[model samples]
Target chain A: MTQTLDIERELCGHAAVGEAAVTVDGDRVVAFVVPAGGGLSLRELRAELGTEPDEFVVLTALPLAEDGQPDWAELSRSRKDLTRRRMPYTAPRTDTERYLAALWEDLIGVEDIGADDDFFTLGGHSLLAVRIRMRLQRDHGVTVAPEALFENSVLSEQAAVVDRTREA
Target chain B: MSQRTKWLLRDPSPEAEARLFCLPYSGVGASVFRRWPSHIGPLEVCPLQLPGRENRIGQPAYGDFPAFAADAADALADHLDRPYAVFGHCMGSILAHALVTELRSRDVRQPERLFVSSSRVPHWPPDRRYRMPAPGAVGVYHPSMTEEQLADEVSRVSRTVGGTDLHPDLLPLALRVLRSDLEMCFGYAPALAPTGCPISTIGWSDDADVPPAEMGVWQECGPVTHHVLPGDKLTFLEAPAELQEVVEKDFRG
Candidate 1:
């Protein structure tokens, strides 16, 4: 019954707010529609993919054809300026670098931890991750979800993720 | 005062019925009560900013609780000329109680009412362990744990206290303040000082740091009316409206 309920919930578009429905293949988010005003804005979305809209629109638009999918391709380029204003900081360098440096110093008492070193592998945990997130937000003025630390555990890898996120 | 101190004022009315002075908890400065005046009408809210934080970072922090109380009481003497009440949270609560006692000793008029939050009576010993880690010793407690593990612990503790994940940079400063507070509480042996002011005790529903059971110790000091709020944790910031209302009611009554 629980498994059926879970499946029912998933079939109902995972109940995610503003998320467009797309094909799901076993645990993967696969193709997803960029819900209008719900998904990242074009400027934010563009920063994540690190490509110009002209070069990437085709790839992004492909997912919109799926059943129950959102019309991501309908996003108006005229709104690019408004989207750019809402996107996170863009210093050519990602916030993850600053966060990682502060985190390493606070946790291990080391001046610097290599960007390639895994955050968890170096004895980082959820509590410290929240602390890192809080510090980044408070000290470095970076907004990061707690999951970011776990998803990209390495410092440089996290930076790459942030860079890609900017492109997207 | 010659020093440039940053103060977040919340004076609801220039001709307020009464003034309410609030003190912050250990490791926390006055900005915590910045929103109190907006909720509680007809009262002048003055949130006291202690040394060593925000704009006063250059000032040395008080080393002992009595010294801190003395400094606060001395500074507050001039501001107490009008109709006023006093409120404090955690260590600030105890300080508020002690300051009332000091006022009596110095023959100053007492506040209309006193509100104490999240701390026991002035004399009770603290229950938490005092384990101050030396410089560069991250392994003193859960050193081998991953950042996820640490963040989980922080989240759990914060859930119990109505706070979010602890900031990494602020953690070190908090630890230092916690150590000093623990030392003060641990080293304290209840003295014979007493105050005649009416007191109200405010407790959070799920505050593990200062449990409800231990708060009964506050009754030893003087007459106290206890009130508890419902929440996953007990924090002044979480229920500022409720706290302000209760304080205003108590002060008027």
Candidate 2:
């Protein structure tokens, strides 16, 4: 089996983790785990396993198919969904969102992105993020840092930043 | 005239005895090497401006290593009519190596030397720990961390090493370039084919990122000459006089 699977199995064996799934995101080994409840931290989990995951995401539950097998698509969707819900932002509704969404779709190649969709989770990287920023400057005369995407990846939040910049 | 094709070179030289094409590290443009003299003795400095950067801001970023190398080789073809060498620091090292292979595949003249700094073998899986949000912490691009946490990390880094402040206005653009370069670095897994060109690997005496000892692995690519210059990884940016002297000496030899 791949080392990622082995790590996932080990993580599941922990008393704090009821179930776990691990995958490679870029160079990072990301483990999405359903904890056994009652105060388990990533630091504590790493200490128990003696392995530091590139990213340790604590999930409410692992997505499973009707056959009781882990559903990979659902798991990916869950990760993105979890990210969107955590950030305090609404869906893209303004003209800036429409403009930014089109540019993001072109570079990230994703269709129908909501204002709540996370850019990084949608496979947005630094280069693509820069493309978005450049396009904003060229087309809209709005400029923000690349970290703005990292901070406010949601379309609406980013749009708000640009709107604030425009107003200022 | 052909300078349009080789837009990566901010300062193109047509009358120099030798040319040294310098590739910038992640998230930066050719402007990073703007401090370097246009001519070090007879060796003209030509800093490469990759796509999605300062001048090529509108061009699409190269998705992979081979494609980037191919584009660079094609753009640099006319300039290669004269003798030339290649230099890359950090992420630029991989570009330098891949570009050499691309040139060879096209049956073009090869560089006299391949100078790589603060980078590992092309095949090695990326060391994600290289870029930290804090001194010893990992910075995830995801929203797992609070926006405040992300801001703190980016601000801390922008204060040091990156050469400029994280001006809210330009930080995103700079980071976008960095991310694109990193994606290229992460996806790089070249075939185990060694080049015929000689290699020179530079390391900082106090660089914790790419230690001087780790530099020996570059020998697998070619006959390597390792040089551990004084100061840390950012030393090249802080005081380039020593680096310039070393390059001048090496090029002369």
Candidate 3:
């Protein structure tokens, strides 16, 4: 059996769990779970799996299509909820910060971005990250690694990286 | 042909000297290119729609890029009577590359050029977490996600494209299609060998995900020319005038 199926089966084998799915969100492994009855807690699920999931979400029932397969569209709704609890906001101050913030707003489709805002929290993914890296090189003639963005998702920190690279 | 089997040929031109077939990034459908003009000079814009999304929602999603390419190449056989090129953005670039190779393998005509925007060459291992299986490896890994996450992505992406919030009722179908598309992407393992056609890559200046340098690795496939376009990845959806100008000049030349 495929590893994904194996994980699902093992998850369903746990008490109080009727169905489970393991999916990746960026670098994290998120498991969507349905309980047999009442409400199942993440603590209980974690104890049963013996391994902590990066993100654990409980669903009344796994969304199923008319064909009876798991509904991925419904499952992906968890990303919305996750974004709400991300790190606090910080406003961009530097010129470089302003430029990136505008771009971020465009790419992320988020209206307002504080300097403390997390890129991933704003719906920034690898593809969008690549776009930002390339834009910096073109517009500023500065080179920075993609990892830099991941490490310094905050606007202030990211501006520091660009400022440092610009000076070098 | 069944209604379910139809491809999205935004503007079909049988007489056009060159055809440009576009593939959507993972988790998206052809509608992503809805704003793209019908023509880039003489080249016709053909946005090929994969199954399990948009109008193709009734069909089963292909398991991997190779399978998707194989089927796409076959279905597009008649259209290939003329000189054509395949364009894919992000993970869609891999699909375009695999489709070109699949066409060559079946003795079908190869594309005149392959345009890959915002993606690395197939040889490059993907993100560490969803790394591609080693060469000669049989399968790719698919990441499991919850429906809420998928809904958030769809809603987020939609807002960028001038779309309103995705209703809760639509989340199930949307996420299902996204998961299937990601499965095809994560499971894809195209042959590492080079193609006869030249390659052109477009990188967004501010993109941090797949930097222009990473896109440079595509040179290994064949002659590669990289162009830096303004804006982020989502800019491609707008099909900005600058992007159109570059593609027009490149394809026409």
Candidate 4:
């Protein structure tokens, strides 16, 4: 059995909640106890595990209890089967290709614009600016200010800002 | 024809009563009214192209309302071989009004009918609150917020309806055009005498940007005929048939 002290070791650059006590069985983390109102959902917990729990893992939070004890078996079955998919937490390619591809698809007549181009320089008025921001947030979970568009005026610069601010 | 620059003509019949010249709204080129000829029967539709757009991009953009209106009047003068009508939307409406005045000043034949769409009459006190967003003001024109952000912003600014992701390259040109248009409207002083042409105003009821009540102010132009259409932004596109009917009734008489 791995000691609670060893299991409490910081993981993924994020500190575990004060009340949450981690238990490790061999190389795998088996379970953890989180505060009642920490806003942590079972889905988030499962995501942190990198895989769904087996029958042994359990949640004791009162909010999670449907009737009696939480059903780990059914929850495990509902969890998505892991494919060779990269998680959102993973760092993306440094190359600007992906960002440019996204910009091209969202913006009409993007071929007429250059990559280092500014949004306002290309005939993006207020109406179109709103559309661009909405598309970026929806597609990439990135929040960009219209002012930032005018300031940076280039894909690479905007992409750098988003990359730096990307949520873990 | 000094090097024809992508002119789309609609001369349905050789004996059409009048040549109707159409002008586009802000941020739009002449191509928007390219299909007007098919709809407005018994009339020849000649959509006027503004400078610094499409094939005319090489030409310097007009700096003010007088310059723009003057250039348009000059461009149309040679084309006005027949009795003509004038129809314009938004910025075009203002230009059309000015063009009529310029024509009168030059003793040129006036348009028999003048149709203004979704614009307030020139003399109405301008709305002070309706400030044009600065060229690079972030999130002012486009919602910088997430969907959640947009909902919050939209709830606040009722004028903004839909959002679009604009091309970066066109941003500068678009800003220049927007700034110039705003300045033109803001600095405009309405002329006293209404144009001698018969006037009609068409507007969308649900267009928050140009509400029907505000659009009604267009009646100050002359013997005004107002037509209100139901629906939201770009409602004219939705009911082109109805719009065409109004144009036919007005122009045929």
The TM-score leader among the candidates is 2
Per residue, candidate 4 scores C-alpha lDDT tens digits across A1-168 of 334444334322233333333444345554444334332333344456533323122222211235754343333221111110111222224544355434532342222234444333332334444555666678777776555543343455656655655553
TM-score of 1: 0.51
- CA lDDT, candidate 3, residue B95: 85
Candidate DockQ scores, in order:
0.04, 0.02, 0.01, 0.01
Ranking by TM-score: 2, 3, 1, 4
Query: How would you class the docking of model 3?
Result: incorrect
TM-score of each: 0.51, 0.56, 0.55, 0.50
TM-score of model 4 (CA atoms): 0.50
The digit string of per-residue lDDT tens for model 2 on B1-253 reads: 1214424443344556898998877666665664454555567777786777654555667879888888888788878887788988877888888888788788788888888887777866555324332345322232233545655555655566443446665555655555666666666666655767888889988776777888888898889888999876556753366787777777776
The digit string of per-residue lDDT tens for model 2 on A66-100 reads 89977666665544533432334445688999887
- lDDT of each residue in B114-179, candidate 1, tens digit only: 888776676643333222333332212233334454445544444544345565644554454444
Instruction: For candidate 3, write residues A54-131 as lDDT tens digits.
Output: 766555457666798876655764444334423455667889988888777655545346776656434454446556
